[model samples]
Target: MENYPTEIQEAVKIMYEMRGNSEGMMTWKNFPLAKQIITLLDSIPNRSEHHTPYDKIFILNFIIDNISSSDTPRFTIEIMEKELALLKEVLPADLEEYNDPLTAEDIEEELQMWRDYIDTEHFSNEEWCRKYSHYMKFDPIERSEIWEEKYYEIESKIDAELMKEDMPRGLGFCFAYWSSKHKVLAEMGIEWQSPQEMNPGVVFD
Candidate 1:
């Protein structure tokens, strides 16, 4: 098996931590089987340079989901091996040959667009408090709705600019994973501000 890339190795380590901390695995007796399956997955060739970490994250989540399904351990290492083999059969021999239309430049552009929009947009005091107040004080569902509305607004702008008929599967997954405003801002190396931080003199009810 090929040595795992640094990012993939890190992802595997995170998966191990998740497995150890999982509440459902307290009495599970299949640590060895889980380890074997994860090791096998760690060796799988990454499908894309930019999407490898996301792919590994997806695989780790799949493993955990399956492992947590039963305390008795429904699947064996051999079964996993067969499944991996079948998966490999459908993969391209040189996955690098496939190019993702969405580049890092594109991501950076979208991130900047989001940042600028957030920085310039004005909201009423009540709406601002609902959107940016601390989680405990304000309704989280309302905050989510505001963020969702903003997210779609930005996404529509991006779609119009790109004008691509179909987004690649891996990029689609990546976008889905980082759907929230905080996550998107973090990706852009920006920190989200609280209501108090953004409006020092303003008081919230």
Candidate 2:
């Protein structure tokens, strides 16, 4: 993989943690896989109030597409296959049939719902905040910006690893577009680069 190891471990962890329990090798295909997975890893909360059934599926697909598994300590290919199958089962027929991708407002609303749910269990929304008491006092925007700065720095590590595959945005928008599709992360104004972070100055943008 060119950037960020391009595996799905993060997705697995996110999905598993979403239920606040462990599904072992289970994954949902109901929504955008990559996005939800990211939310999970990012410790973003869920909000059924903000999304319809279809939006949930979109979220699954989004996270599944973006998270990597290679990051796991002893993950097996069999586990990956099982998770993939489960994901497929949860997916809606013809995701492309829908247009008008979600907006930042949509993400915020959904995330807020998740926040309300987790608040009873997890004190702070941000992962770092939960880890450290100091971060708990920071405003939402401030915490978001802090993470944005960190992600941007990570981006610099793999800025130049573009491979130019048959990306969803056709090629021109492959780099920046894909990166910005992460609404919460995008709000921080950070660019997406390779997850592995090996090359630099080789992005499509």
Candidate 3:
């Protein structure tokens, strides 16, 4: 696999830490599997505020599709099957039909939401400002420019990755989307075991 950008590495590191790993994994290819597992665990009822009921199932499917198409050595057939089973175990019985495909309109709306939040709520909203008060000390103009640049970089990479799967404009929203999602998942109250936990003795095959 090609080298991942520093921004992606940082995102992956934060996610691993979210799972209680003191040191983030260096292997990038395995990230899709890890991301899928986290989404599955977070989907469980009452697991976390981020729990989207069955919405996580769809996200898992999307991640799996990407993994299947990527030319990476991160996931073996055995590991994939194990992870899928773990995800299925949490599915709610009688899940109502869900067919909300991410459309161009939805992407645009999401992008707008991100932009609005960053430009307004990021520094004005009490909770948001309180949580990120340290960053607030920076010059407003410089800070805004830095954030916009980072968002552009991350979303640009995401756009390229999604393009490879013919999923243009799929997940190129902004930092807010990922940050809120992970913040919610951090509350996954239960001790959700991931596929890596199934074979703790091995790092990766």
Pick by TM-score: which candidate is best?
A: 3
What are the C-alpha RMSDs, in order, of all predicted structures? 19.8, 18.1, 20.6
Q: Which residue segments of model 2 deviate by more than 4 Å?
A: 1-25, 28-61, 64-98, 121-205
Residue 152 lDDT, candidate 3, scale 0-100:
29
- Worst lDDT run of 10 residues, candidate 3, spans 68-77
Cα displacement (Å) at residue 146, model 2: 25
Candidate 1, residues 1-205, lDDT tens digits: the string is 1365655656566556556645432223234445555676557664554444335434543454544321211233233333434344334433354454223343344333323223324543345445545233222222332443344343334444333434443434333322343444455454555444455576543
Using all chains and alpha carbons, the TM-scores for the candidates as numbered come to 0.21, 0.19, 0.23
The backbone clash count of each candidate, in order, is: 0, 41, 0
Q: Residue 67's C-alpha lDDT in candidate 1?
A: 45
lDDT of 1: 0.41
**Angstrom error at residue 158, model 3:** 17
Superposition error at 156 for model 2 (Å) = 36
Q: Who is ahead in lDDT, 1 or 2?
A: 1
Off by over 4 Å in 3: 1-53, 68-70, 73-79, 86-94, 100-205
